[model samples]
Target: MTCFSPKFMAFCAALACLSGQAPADTAQGAHVSIELNALEPIEDACRISFLVQNGHDTDIEQAVYEAVLFDTEGRVDRLTLFDFGALPAARPRVRQFLVPGLSCADLGRLLINGVETCTGDGIPADACTDGLELQSRADVEVLG
Candidate 1:
């Protein structure tokens, strides 16, 4: 099952930022990309699913992704997703996050904040050391 917890997201947010890298930055030596696949309204909240593709020569054992949803009034909400198991090289892994009580109409933009803890090929490295080319989605609309 998908793990949906703000505390975990907060922890990831702290750990990822502590490494001294901007969320928009990509990890060097790691060919990884993020794509937002869906953003739909559910009740009062919205659900977002996306893919994390590994293009490097090594496998990705785990990753913590943080994203921010912004509204027109400047209210910001954080949505986080993670794959703590394994993501093979040149493959894609799908993950999802939920923004509680947030409507799709309220979303103005989506930003991929950062990626945390990338381990593979029997080594742990900083994926965001060189800055990532963030794949952010704008001009998005929710359809019923």
Candidate 2:
């Protein structure tokens, strides 16, 4: 079963077409989905892996995404930025980041947040304007 809630999925779907750029958020739109694959706890950091899937027919030259992690106190504990380069069409790209001093239990929630930049075929792309999805597993693992 999927770890993401239906409400969150709907939110992502609704934001998927937030832009009006051609092939970006238009009817003939391009889309991307972000999923939290795994969270690995290291010495003083959390190794986060995100699976970015390009749903558009065009190649995504680059995409900058954010992962907002809330702490146990329900406050914004850490905000991490991740970049996925050369994401080919219709393929899932795995991007990993090491967040210092973050544990799986410390994470209260994960937000797809937003895309900072997107490019396609050497030109600017509105991939994120169409909004991207985010999901996290209920059962997260911890590793030393």
Candidate 3:
């Protein structure tokens, strides 16, 4: 299952894409961004692995659970529209999600957990707009 809910996740995704944040009262709070970078295709089981970035202005003290992908064909009931995990990286933080048996070919999105955090120390607080990026061709070659 993906973190984004199919029935309503599209609405959330749209808000995030337009406003750079989940929709108003999305339960994702404010002043946060999720950038789904690379979704590297894996042949064996999953379609691809992802690299997500979580950012805030301050620091993350408590642990918040988050998930990526949102939805898939068969993986829905198995997992859930939302996965649970903790955010270890605080502000000025960019964490990567390495989902083993998951794919991102169809969906250009990754999973992320956002429960607790403080403003990070990345220059101008607003300067950090949590963004995601795909793995570079060079990096993929090295990993391959």
The candidate that wins on TM-score is 2
Instruction: Quote each prediction's TM-score.
Output: 0.61, 0.69, 0.34
In model 1, where is the ten-residue run with the lowest total lDDT?
Answer: 20-29
Q: What lDDT does the true structure give each of the candidates? A: 0.56, 0.65, 0.36
Q: Which model is ahead, 1 or 2, in terms of TM-score?
A: 2
Prediction RMSDs, each to the true structure: 14.3, 9.3, 13.1
Candidate 3, run of 10 with poorest lDDT: 135-144
lDDT by residue for model 1 (1-144), tens: 222486665554345445432222222434556666677788878776665565555676776655566775656655554443576665556777667887877777766556656666653476422334445353452111
**Model 1: residues with Cα > 4 Å off, grouped in runs:** 1-30, 79-85, 128-131, 136-144
Cα lDDT tens digits for candidate 3, 28-134: 43333433334555663343323223434334333233333434342331221222133323222344444555444444323343323333344333322333222
Which model scores highest in lDDT? Answer: 2
Candidate 2 colliding pairs: 16-130, 44-101, 45-101
lDDT of 2 by residue, 1-144 (tens): 222675765555455434321233333345666667887888888887877677677788877876577776778887777787778876667888888888877876776567777887643456664645456555532110
Alpha carbon lDDT at 83, candidate 1: 47
